[model samples]
Target chain A: MQSSIKQWQDWIGGIAAQGKFVGTNRLGFEGKTLKPNQVISDGPYAEVKEMVGGYLLVKADGIDDAMKLAEACPILQIGGHVEVRNVIPMSR
Target chain B: MNEKTLIQQLFKSEYRKIVSVLCKLFGAHHIETAEDIANDTFLLASETWGVKGLPENPTAWLYTVAKNKTKDYFKRRHIFSGKIVSELKYSQLNSESFEMDLSEENSKDSQLKMIFVLCNPLNPTESQIALALRILCGFGIDEIAVAFLTNKETINKRLFRAKEKMRMANIEMELPNSSEIHSRLETVLSTLYLLFNEGYHSSSQHSPLRKELCLEAMRLNYFLIENEATNQPMVNALMALMCFHASRFEARINAFGQAILYDEQDRTLWDEELIAKGNYFLIESAKGNEISKYHIEASIAYWHCTATAHNGKWEHILQLYNQLLQIEYSPITALNRTYALSKVQGNERAIEEAMKLQLNENHFYHCLLGKLHSEQNPKKAMECYEKALILATSSSDKRTIQNHLKKLR
Candidate 1:
């Protein structure tokens, strides 16, 4: 499950290269989340209770591919879950 | 195809709809929460949708997701103890609930009411208008900052303060009463006009004019007109005035986006349709006995629009300006009137009248003085140009004045 979760993370990181990811928490995060292609840095001192445990990023194909990718993610072993969603483009 | 385009498109359409819906479901007091939830829903969609191949009914899907998100928000906030939350929960099951209608109207009304609330004279000077343009008009902080000639951080601070005041005042999202409507309406109109002016004459280097800002302002004015209680003649007159001015937008600049003087512009490129619409509004505005400043301004624009090569009637424009001055005294109007007077009665009288008035030490006033003095006294013109260059806020304006000074030299 850990390896699968890592695979899911790798899939997301890969998809994110071609897509976008948005993060939100009921609790405020230290600094803003990085944009797509922005390198993440360390040492903001994340609160143990408020750390982001999972993420999602859109890719081509469909949710089937998304879920298939998520199935391999490492988080599920540690009780973390990934939810795949499709974004609806805004109408002009 | 790309994530950026997708996100942009989503924001363009669903951003308002989702925000409006969420704002209604939540109370006016929890608007910030509602906005956050709406934004979160979009972010979620952006992350998930690329792999999902998009939804069949994206808007409906978003609405459902937002609704669920709002419920989660309430749960997290522990707001379910209130009778309002119980009522919302009870009505949630009934798909055709009256709450839906009320909520829909409430959202739009909240935005409209916010415009007035932000523009309240008791608030920070001109900052509320800037705030409303940012929030209500959907303008970016950078855009608002540029419009007001302030830094983004300053604009952000002003917006924060304005919002804090609203929260402290516990301002309800209710429309003003008839007696209070006129005063509130003035603020709303001014905010819209400010937004339109920013778009009409943007100082940004990359894009000189942001037409989107103008269109958004006009859209808000249309919304104002739709409200039965708010549809005063002055509102109509203002709308007409904007339409008339916006009609000439295409002809206002050349391909290079340099400022095209009125006399130099090609009249053929002006949008006749917009002019006609403006005239229609102007005629509608005259139905009542009271004439507003908008009526006078629209009439002046109409005169300019209808002028032909054989008869570019400056007298009619001057008359409108005279009527405008009687209604409201502003230095900007005086400056404009002086220019028309120069065209009709000649430069000496125009210069004499302009010289008497004490304008706020601004670059435009000095530039006008420089132009007025250029023909008669090159030395004086040079001095005026130097003052204008010193005071100029925009690089383009400064460059133009510098060129004028160079010519004089």
Candidate 2:
């Protein structure tokens, strides 16, 4: 049931070789949760029992292409999912 | 079992139950098929229970599924026709109805007999031990390998040969006839006794795989007690002895995984409940006039558990050991008796008896001699410790001897 680190590395290496690598960031647990009346709690998302394994960004042609790319990620093989979001550029 | 360990513990127990019953129904030659059905049942449980949680009566749920699977197996392949019992003749007779008996009573009967079936005397003792560990205890090949300190291929080969022997003998999973019952039961009990001893005094104490091996042996022995034909006096004595030994299991090992000698173990860690169980079974064992070596050994164990200063505990233990050696003479048992001899008759006489055995290659022999001389003769104790330190195999034992040497200095 354990997906090894080598598997993750190999999959990521394949994507990087294809020149579609964008960026990645691990979630910093040192954050706050702001409630309805601005009451904040100093912890990670308290409600999520399923752990979030941080995020990876990838360059793609379109949303469908990005979806296709996301579908090939190793996370999907191990019962994990990928959310394909558009990173709109801030043009000056 | 709680939700965390519910599946595992159920698998350990229910796997054997279902397999035993299936082995009886499907015949010993189809043992693999029986195992496959049990495995599939567990696989289904792991998937379903993970999603829906455990059923109210999980064992019943498993039994119901196993029954259905057996029914499906019968339907898929016509395993038994009316003419021949085991033909595997496929047919298109959908109208032919089948009934399976997966009742609790049948399951108990099946398992009680399965122990003897696995420990068939035709097979070598090693093969019997391997088969018993595999079928009865639900131990994996890898686990059995770890237990035996061997590789998987060797274990697999032994299992194959043992199964071949079973097939050759045309063995069926049932109790022996009244004429053969005594001898057959002796083989079964001896296998269980060796299994328990393997767990207690294994070469690799820290392996952790043997952590439950002793309990598994006791559990298998318990099935014999539950059955009428197999519930002889010797069975209760063995169970009593196991209970007595198990009661001190926790006290025998310290936080550092070092073995604590009987004298040094904290009395508070002794399990009162298990001692009570041992007492009950000892009483049960004494009902018959047949005094097995197990009975005498259990009496000695009882003395160890309930010893007071003025109670002549060592004397009674020494007497019991003498009785045990008379019933069954083994070098190891006689070696153990000398420890009691030292306690009862002082060091000099015990040392003489211990040396007569001439177990020069055995580290325990030298270790015992070292203990006997530690008070009166430091030079002799040092020499014995040196021999023990070199001859000892396990690190824990070496450490124990090292401690003795430290004191002797």
Candidate 3:
């Protein structure tokens, strides 16, 4: 498992070396979940099968390019998949 | 170590050096631009390294990324072929020059040069110290605010105004000429002294962070002393004074975070290594005929550190304090000298001298009076203690005064 993790890291490092990686944020356990009843509770609900461990902000040309960049993510090896979304910049 | 922690540590240590070099290349007017590039480089490191793991040559990697980013900035602004190219005229902007300029020796030179630029005599002392804290020391706006007992907005405005002056004046980031060196060096030393005092008597609720401030001040002063051109007697004396004070940092507070009086501090807790360093610097400071206020203060501290007994030690401290008062007359120093006088000349004369000073409003002055009168008259001591308790601002100081009151009761 450690060796495979090492291999996974090398792949990410290759992407980083190209100056494509912008930033990453860890998804913490302590967050709010809103319900239809206007109720709030501790969240990222543990009942869910898969959860966002974190996210990486990578620089790519388009949605397809971004998906391609996320294709080799280590989560895939552990029966998990990634969701890619376009980041919009609000006009100042 | 975790990648995040490593990057943060690197940022702390290398941020100033990288910014210093960039400012040297880009000039003081463009310091903000230099800072932005340096900040972006660290941000990139955090983003990339957080997922990919650590690089083998992290510092070099950082330097390379920062250099590339700075070049990109020049290209984006379209200044490489225009303003920058003509402004720096004979020297062109290229990766080679960037690499050469940010070399180890050049980095040190830039930092030393930045010191003088930040300490420009024309600038307000507050702004000069604030710039030193922000630019030279890599402190955040919030930390600088905390140090200055002000809000972040005020500190931000102070830094902005300081930078604006540098821009308007087009200040050069280099050592002052020989004639100005004496005055310039004095400004630098006093700024460092203020910085160290901020750390030692830090306003922070957290005790340990205050020590970090003191250590930061010492680190900067040590840099000045290391360079041959700046290593004068006064600088060494200042360093010796800082070291001596720093040696007692651990003993200055108790487990409860209360200020421990000097007489009550556990001498065993004093850092012997720092004391030895202080002694070495003190010996080095004696090389020239010049004796600064720092010289007298450091000697008094040295005697305080070495003397195991109260016997015959007060005479030496009293003499140094006398010399220091002759050279520089601060009310606090006068109060301290009066306290020293009580040891050698008895309480009556010390009280007579202390009462003449114009420090009635100061809690410490009342506290000293309380001590001086405690041995002679209990009623007078209680009155002084009550006055001190009312005037005291820090909760810890009030607690100490109350303790004295309780003992009397």
Model 1: per-residue Cα lDDT over B1-409, one tens digit each: 7655766665655565555554445444555776687778878888877777677766666677777776666667675445445444244543223233324566576566655656676576567667666556655678777767778999888877777776677666567888999988887788778778778877754454377778878888888888778788989999998999999988987788777777778989999999999998888888788787788888888887885724647766765665566455566776777777677768887787666555638778888888888898999989988988988887678778888999999
Regions of model 2 farther than 4 Å from truth: A1-92, B1-4, B48-57, B78-96, B206-208
Best candidate according to TM-score: 3
User: Candidate 1: what lDDT?
Assistant: 0.69
- In model 1, where do residues sit more than 4 Å from their true spots? A1-92, B1-6, B21-26, B83-111, B140-153, B309-312, B358-362, B373-387, B390-393, B403-409
Against the hidden reference, what TM-scores do the models get? 0.71, 0.75, 0.79
Query: Of the candidates numbered 1 and 2, which has the greater TM-score value?
Result: 2
Kindly indicate the candidate among 1 and 3 with the higher TM-score: 3
What is the alpha-carbon lDDT for the whole of candidate 3? 0.81
In candidate 3 chain B, what residue range of length 10 has the lowest lDDT sum? B92-101
Candidates in descending lDDT order = 3, 2, 1
Residue-by-residue lDDT tens digits, candidate 3, B1-409: 9887787678768988998987777677778888899899989998988888888999999998988898788778887667766655246555336442678898999999889888887788888888988877778788888777889999999889988988999998778888888889999888888888888886566666678778888999999999998999989998999999999998988888878999989999999999999999999999999999999999999988984756678867766776665555576777787887788779997787676565878899999999999977988999999999999988888999999999877
- List chain B TM-scores, each candidate: 0.85, 0.91, 0.96
